[model samples]
Target: MVKKWLCAVLVSWWCLCLWAAGAEHAGEKPLNWHENAFFGLHFDLHPNAGDTELGRETTAEHIREMLEKVKPDFVQYDCKGHPGYTGYPTKVGAPSPGIINDALKIWREVTREMGIPLSIHYSGVWDSRVLEEHPEWARMDPHGNRHPNYVSLLSPYPTERMIPQLLEVVREYDIDGMWIDGDCWAALPDWSPACQAEFTRRTGIAEIPKKAGDPHWEEWLAFHRTLFKEYVARYVAAVKAEKPSCLVTSNWSFTVRMPEAMDVPLDYISGDYDPSFGAERAMVEGRFIASRRVPWDLMTWSFLKTGDQPWTFKNAAHLSQEVSTVMAQGGAVFIYDTPQRSGRLNSWHMDVLAEVARFCRERQPWCHRTETVPQIAVLHSESTWYTRNDPLFNFGGANQPMEGALFALLESGWSVDLLNETALAERAGQYPVIVIPEVTRLPEAFRQAMAEYVEGGGRLLISGGEAAEMFGELAGITFA
Candidate 1:
């Protein structure tokens, strides 16, 4: 009973604030996302098999009102979610249940009429519906059982379903772009018969590594990463060929979570950040992405949430502080607003966004696609990270020692940028000091590179036990 009251009160308070800050936008239209757009908004209803009121309450007036007030440079609306169902009446894909009307059509029309660029939130790899419909396409676990959610990259899902759906949407609706989600982060190693045959074919290793510590584990892992990267590249190429102007990106593909050298042909790089307090996450992600030398944005969940608590909207001041961390490092800002099941804009939440927008715009002159003035250099090593990180993409909730190093630097008042092996290779000698944080496994090639840098008068700080032992050759004196 108390929980119900708290939820009701939070709703009332949110609505009140949104109503209070009902400011209108000027006559300026938003710039193209590929060109230069610092601020954006994303909404995904994530309709499942049980959704009963899809498109019931979404109207042009409500959408127009929200767009006019928020004035985002680009808007990513719901099309398909992890459940593998389209929100609208999709001819090429499965539409979610309880579609009273066309909600996606409404969003596209309203945004088009208002001149706001629109993109769809499309899920890749992690589609439950596809797994349910065709179990043969499912990934085979190491124990030879069918994995629950992901489809095999070697399967026909991409050609028959994923790519066709993407091409259909852009061909039919003419939306600006697509934001592919559930990719990379949801990827896992596949031990299917086809994958196994190919794995042996490519690596010349007859036996597959069951887990992380197997004899040829690194070779097995490297093979999987290459294949998954090919899967992403295939779809991106299809999208570009179909509609050359359409923007596309796979979430967390090149970010710190799966930090590789920027090898994929992404028009722009982006990831919607995790919902924990958000300020800390923005700082770490912003610093790494800034070093990638591309246009990127870090998203914030405008509401605070943890465990099973109700989603409560964060105040503008708190949101601003989070955005400041990203913008200061020259990263674009995107806010995710959880949509009501009824498909209507909650005016109260718009009020919070209005205030946050003002704060970001005020500091736009000094930030947005700017470079960090390079002070302290920290290596977020891809080779060292992938060496032992058994999981394909996500670290499975492990706290990063590299992040802790960055925090220590911040507390001691030094400007820092988190860089991958590729970025550091380009400008290694620019920074005075390079700190390698607690890396247990580093390639011999990188070790030689670091030794050369140190020999050339570069100051190297090797943190943690294994790193100290490995880099001890540079101490220039023997310890007792």
Candidate 2:
């Protein structure tokens, strides 16, 4: 009996060891060129109605010229845009009425000749054609009316149409990857019958909230957030299942817009920074993406607008500055440009991009794979951003004290990283100082993690009355 018990225990121990080894291997992935300083171009090709004749030969010549001049490692040309029009001839979906030639095919062939990887900018959730063809796929509002703008992922269109179309492009084109646009950031609370039924089935909450202030509003928003996240995961899995080597990512997947989305299996993370906000936002976004241990690049628009009008091309000096901020935080850079409706390249824009590329090339060695020694970490509560819609506390609050705190820290020349609750809990001890930044509502686990961090001799710089009230003792302050 004793010998048999010992044999059983040894077998169990050996099985546990094998399970651990397998778990570790599951998390490992091979690094690619995207991990280095990749200078890329994102060409937007949404032409106006009158500009239908997209001179294929001229466009190819322009692409060749641009490639020769700019020398980008990768180029993301438009396959589909927010308007839900395909740049290439398609049997599945609506091709742009204005496009006379298959521009995507042309670009793919040219980029292949140039020995550069080509990625497609395909709109995911915010597709207009899906909404127009199947109104049932549109996100329904409180009034039972469909939103004309974006498609609901909870509907059947994503599985039936979106994923299949993505696979179609991958199988047909000689493309490297896909940068899926308008995913999590464009998600809305869907009250469609399918969504409601699924929500009720999952949560057992029979009553659905109609408005923001209604009971269970927070729960409803949380459900929708998870729904969009799951949708992205499904799309990524579907694409990879078809083409395992095909890299895939949704815009703003790991950025401030949807930090939790970093958990999704993406080849990389990227987003176009608002040129109006300048380099400050880039710096903030870069640090956030870096924390996720993934390759990331932030794109800057070529033209900066004054109000509703496009004023002028952002010069090389301005662009170089933006690139500097991204690189400083250990990220690559991509400059965004819009091609003319007639499929002509702007020589002057090519010159500007060349100059920017030269700047990145010179600094690539120091910037690539460099580690950021974070001195401070600011908590960016994704939960707070999702559930709470108060103008003073939510997205409209200008990010409130969080932005203010980050700005002050940047001005003071302090290296900062924005961490969500999960990251904060896991990495709280790594930072010498952690800032709460006026957050009122926080999970108990995160609060306890901070407390333990402080007890372990980590410094805490917390702002706001609510935070002060909760952690006053740790900061050696008495609250009334």
Candidate 3:
């Protein structure tokens, strides 16, 4: 039977996010991320150290032209990226070489004048600059070698650099907020002396595990994960305390990729799905965020992964398909684009953006803030994924069985919501059918809950060897 339910439509078309470089709104009241900020444009270059002539050609006319044509809800411009270089010159942060013009000023002026919320894409945890300069702050790998890209949480990088730069941009540009990238996904397990010392104090585990198979391996991973969570909470709190109105979100913090409950003080939740399987990735990410209690959106890469192309811009129809996938899943959508080295958008790029804008606006009235009517609850087990995978968040890692299961149900045309142990515990009987897909292990509490739910006549569907063995008797399935 194809699981189905009524789709409750809440129609409030959001503004276009025409972010040529920086940018929001149609209604009399200004739209923000909390409510009406729907369609968006994300333009980034991931600022590098060797970059020169940054924003030299990003004139007022070019930004205004693109904004007028697309008229997005909010515009997110590149501020700081993985390289730890700032696009705009700042008194506090490491500025890129040869930044001639005040591009951030121009973007803020135009966006503010046009009454649109202009946010920034700032790289948080991963900083090559920080790693090179402060070798002591680097996250040490199990082999005693400091990471070449990531920073250690036990170090003062967050306090000394990350938070200061955030506050600096907030106060300097008077910008809307920041979409923090390279954060949760960029976190590496810190095995540095400082981290190990602190981990020992907290957990009383004197012997630190050097590898995943060593003694107290789970404890070591859990300890690092806890520290990363603290790092996020601290920075978010600091930013909000400094600018209470500014929105803050780390890309993919509490999404399906993390398989954890929403605990951070994130103003919104988001993640940029890898373009390799762009459509399929959105199918999982979009639905998971839509099920979240906070405001959320998914960013789509504007181009496909062509080996030679730096960023090969996809045609309007191709991008529109990705946008439609996100819109149909009941969350706002943003299309990611890379501008020229001079920070100017070429006409070729504009042509595709304008066409994509038309497509997104056309569907705005119907799919804006669409809510999922949950019919099938696909359990995304935190224990299962964490035990199998190494990182805290696995966006581009192995395709957990949950992905295949969700994809199968979706292809079969069932309305599904991906839920984890925390979510299911609160509402075990909510979904009409609960499907446990091939998990190596499940919490005993969940097993008891599922058994009780089945005893009370709720449908339970178990698949895969491990999952089937766990609930084989409950499912009344016998294997020879």
Q: Which 10 residues in a row give candidate 2 its minimum summed lDDT?
A: 387-396
The list of candidate 2 runs beyond 4 A from truth reads 1-31, 47-51, 55-59, 389-394
How many residue pairs in model 2 have overlapping backbones? Answer: 0
> Model 2, range 431-455, lDDT digits (tens) per residue?
9999988777788888899999988
TM-score of 3: 0.90
Q: Could you give candidate 3's per-residue lDDT for residues 398-434 as a string of tens digits?
A: 4468888898998999998888887786777777798
* Per-prediction CA RMSD (Å): 8.6, 10.7, 7.0
Alpha-carbon TM-score of each model against the true structure:
0.90, 0.89, 0.90
Q: What is the lDDT of residue 452 in candidate 1?
A: 82
The local distance difference test score of each candidate is 0.81, 0.78, 0.80
Enumerate clash totals for all models, in the order shown.
1, 0, 9
Model 1 misplaced stretches (Cα beyond 4 Å): 1-32, 396-399, 443-445, 477-480
- The candidate, 2 or 3, that scores higher on lDDT is 3
lDDT tens digits by residue: candidate 1, 100-157 = 8788888888776655668899999988888888888988888999977898999888
What ranges in model 3 sit over 4 Å off?
A: 1-32, 307-310, 395-398, 477-480
